[model samples]
Target: MRYKNLIFDADHTLINYTADERDALKRIFEEIGLKFSDKMLDRCCYLSEFTWTETGLYDVKNERIQREYHNLYKTHLDLLFTRIFTEFPCSFSPIRAGELLLKYLKDGTNSISHAEETIKKLKTEKGYNIYIATNGLIDIQVGRLKRFAPYLDGLFISEELKEIKPNPLFFKKILERLNCTVKECLMIGDSLLSDIAGADGVGMDSCWFNPKSKENQSGTKPRYEIKDLTDLLQIL
Candidate 1:
């Protein structure tokens, strides 16, 4: 095999984060006595992504911003609902709503189409060591990824590692933990910024999992691009 280690990104790439997030958001709204609507869900999703990016989660090149993000990550979940629902008046506490959302999200183990099969094939059939590299909350990610435990050799979460993706240090730490060289690993993920850029920053190979066929406005380029998970089989 050309690559001995397959480092997959959790959200969108493997785990169906959008599906899980929609479910979690609906459940939280219902639990908090708010009428759930698709419009509400869309608004929430928009705000969630906006806030995450604004909070420096994707600021890969700035050392000061990265350090600030590390400090903010601890209370990120606690303040998420508060930030999202600032315009809407709610009877329930935002913190409690956040906790409930976390609970529902943790129980959501939905995976992308062909994700499990691809992972199993890569690990068992192709003899590649499969792993997950994510910048998600540790508690939620660990719970959701438990189903992949049989195939996964290890998981790297930025929350625990104290570094986020697109940073060379984060990939460096992962390489050290795997005891593998950059050339031996291939990062596969949907995010061009986090996964492709991060891997490339470390002089590693990457495959952009662009299932949506989204245009790549970002300057960072991946070594390969695939619209489906099974395409990785051919690339490897």
Candidate 2:
């Protein structure tokens, strides 16, 4: 085999998260007596991506830094809801509104096409060690991967490890855990920053799973590119 270990990103890489995210955002806003608009959804997405990007910058090495990380995350969420209500003229309190949206996002996820089957073939038939290297809330990533848990050899989550990808340390830790070298592994994910860049940092081969054929402007390049999940079967 070309690679013995396969690291996959859980969200857009293996799951169709856009529809679920939009519906969840809409439902949360509606339940709070606010009119859900595409603009609101777009704003939510912008805020969330910014918050996550800021949160991922902190690499906690001690208890104090870890506490600061949590504080930073809470502060970001606080500002997110405040901006939401301020910009949209909602009557609801930001705290409660934020909680409702968080609850929905944590509990909902939908798998992408051929994700389960492709994983099964890789793990069962191909005999490759498969793990999910994802950055998200522990409970949320767990909720999404629970059904695939038995098939997966391991999961490296940002919330639990206090580490996010695009950082070489995240990939280093995963490589250590898997007892594999960078040459022996391949990263498959949608994000250039978190997946491809991080893998590049650690000298690991990466495959960009661009299902939408999105243009790559991030400058970080992948060793391979595939539009469909099942395209992995042929590559391996």
* TM-score of candidate 1 to 2 decimals: 0.90
Clashing pairs in 2: 15-112
List runs of model 2 lying over 4 Å from the truth. 37-73
Task: List TM-score per model, in order.
Answer: 0.90, 0.81
lDDT of each residue in 1-236, candidate 2, tens digit only: 98988999988888766666666778877787778778779888787677656664334334454445545655666677787788788878777766666567666656888899999998999899889998766766677687677789899987777667766777888888877789999999998877898889889999999988999998988999999899998989
Off by over 4 Å in 1: 70-80, 83-87
Best by TM-score: 1
Which tens-of-lDDT digit does each residue in 1-236 have in candidate 1?
Answer: 78889999998999998789889988888776777678878888887777677776667667876666655553565566786677566767777877787789898877999999999998999999999999867888899999899999999998888888878999999999989899999999999888998898989999999998999998988999999999988888
Give Cα-based local distance difference scores for all models: 0.85, 0.79
Give the number of the best model, judged by lDDT: 1
**Model 2 backbone overlap count:** 1
Candidate 1 residue pairs in backbone clash: none
